[model samples]
Target: MAIAKLDVVALDCPEPRKLADFYAALLGGALVDDEAENGWVVLSTPGGRLAFQESPGYRPPVWPSTEHGQQLHLDLTVEDLDRAEKEVLALGATALDTEDRSRSWRVYADPVGHPFCLCAG
Candidate 1:
């Protein structure tokens, strides 16, 4: 028996709407923008749902460092690595790791500094 079910992955950021829009465009989802909701945004996609929470004092983590480690990172698989990288960079994602040509994955930091991988699966 499962104790609880995993619902949605929420990312904390200074601005919810902007972050939500970024993810919606990347994931091909609709941003559920409710005027009543003050500091949150939800993107509902065919695969799953992503929620962005507003944190006034949000501070992005520094990857590969123990002082401020990555809270969590999304591993997104793509059909073509080259194409995906081009698209993400245009969407304000910074390239974090793309040196190892032997590897099947590349790392990129989202607009809000959250690290995510573009994996070839």
Candidate 2:
């Protein structure tokens, strides 16, 4: 059989609980899974399941450096960039970079240094 669509995308983080909470708040708590625990967290959004795996020795990515490399990133579709950005920042997301703020997209990083983007998709 052919491969099925992606069910989950997991990220490595030092503290799964903290990172998961950030996403949970941003996604309106509807994307979070009931099975999320201290070591592992899962977000079940309409797009797909986003999971965070605990890495005790996890070292965050150093973007623009490319020395360590970005392991993974999430792209979220939004209707309003400005409003979305404000909500994300309030949810513990730090503004890392914005390739085209005037455009329909903006990039931001989570508290643990994982990069994600908001696009008009």
Question: lDDT: which candidate is best?
Answer: 1
List, residue by residue over 1-121, the lDDT tens digit for candidate 2.
Answer: 8689767889889877677778877775454564446577787765667788888788888775677877777888888888898899888888877756677778788999998888886
Q: Model 1 lDDT vs. the true structure?
A: 0.86
TM per candidate: 0.93, 0.84
Global lDDT of each candidate = 0.86, 0.79
Which candidate has the highest TM-score of all? 1
Instruction: Please list the Cα RMSD from the true structure of every candidate, rounded to 1 decimal place.
Output: 1.5, 2.2
TM-score result, candidate 2: 0.84
